[model samples]
Target: MSIWWSLHLRREAASVPLARRLLLGTMETAGVDPDISYDLSVALSEACANAVEHGGDTPDGTPQAYRVTAYLDGEKCHIEVTDSGPGFTAPHRAPRPASSDAEGGRGLCLISELADHVQIGNKPGRGGAVVSFDKILKWRKDAPLMAV
Candidate 1:
């Protein structure tokens, strides 16, 4: 079975820092390669930011909380970013990047390009959605050994 770690927070922007730390800590604990930490951090942060922005608040204008779950399975680390707001649909894939544009709905697109795998959709049994992704760990043969 895979190992798992979870973090829950409210809809406020302040919670982002805490989320990042937890994710980094979890990855480290699971023996993820130090070299890929930056990629994981950026991808996870983007997913969590989307959750906080779109899923945490009630569609009716009330405040709500959010949750982020991360786990490691053998050679891959998985992350799920979920929220308390009503469910939403993932945006359709955009066409090739225009040569001169600077702004748009490219967050998910960028994440998909970076992460090994990406899943975005509603959380079953719960309202709202989750943006999940996984990254394959690259082991360093010369690194100090740590018992699994």
Candidate 2:
């Protein structure tokens, strides 16, 4: 089975869980393996949290909304979170924060560890940060998500 969705949400703390719930519901309904679903959802939460906290750094004031997109094609799932904040200078090499006790700065590190493939950069033309990731889906034998 193939499924896809896109969400444009306000850059607010409340919107983070909304995005996560949608992802979780879609993955569960699609019969993706529980472990995989959980991992991706956690990673997605980190990405969404980053977007919410940093999405409004545009010169003309912070962007009011961010975009989250997810696609499931057979045994693979891809997700992207885009924000209107100033793009990251270096997402290709996200090292753990120097201060372990720091309350933040670990989003990208967590995402990189969970996702099989990840791409981070500025959105085409729009000049925003885009964090995209893909993982091979592991499905439950009886979920009927695909031929599996």
Candidate 3:
């Protein structure tokens, strides 16, 4: 079986936890292993937080909303978070390690570390950052929706 969801959320601090909880609930209902669920939830939170903090305003000065999309297919899970910010300066390169004294700038690096594969880039023409990642799925012993 395959499951997928997409969310359009405002760029607000509270939205981060909301997105995390939704992902957790989906994982739990699908009977994914708890460890893997936790890791994905954390990565999702980081990505949402970045969007809330850095998703820029529109040309008319309105705050831009962001999007979160997730898919569970066969034995893999993929998630993507997109924002209307200025986008990464160097979309092709991996994010550099955050300085020890920095309070931020570590989210992308952390996402890459947690997922089996990650892609950080910009949405063509639209001009926004896109952070997408994929992870090998691990089902619980009693998974109801386990891959065939």
Poorly placed runs, candidate 3 (over 4 Å) = none
TM-score of each: 0.76, 0.90, 0.95
lDDT of 1 by residue, 38-113 (tens): 6878887777777777765566776688888887666777888888667765553432453456655556766787
User: With candidate 1 superimposed using the best TM-score fit, by how many Å does residue 35's alpha carbon deviate from the native?
Assistant: 3.2
Off by over 4 Å in 1: 56-62, 90-104, 141-148
Candidate 3 shows a clash count of 0
Q: Tens digit of lDDT per residue, candidate 3, span 54-101?
A: 898978988799999999876989999999998877736776789999
For candidate 1, what is the TM-score?
0.76
lDDT (10s digit) by residue, model 2, range 1-148: 6899999999889998999999999988888999999889999999999899888644667556999999998879999999987677654565465477888888888898999998888877766789999999988887867644
- Per-residue error at 98 for model 2, in Å? 4.6
Query: Candidate 3 lDDT (Cα, whole model)?
Result: 0.91
The weakest ten consecutive residues by lDDT in model 2 span 89-98
* Residue-level lDDT for 17 in candidate 2: 93
Give the better candidate number (1 or 2) by TM-score: 2
Candidate 1 lDDT (Cα, 0 to 1): 0.72
- Which candidate achieves the best lDDT against the true structure? 3
Error of 3 at 107 (Å): 0.5
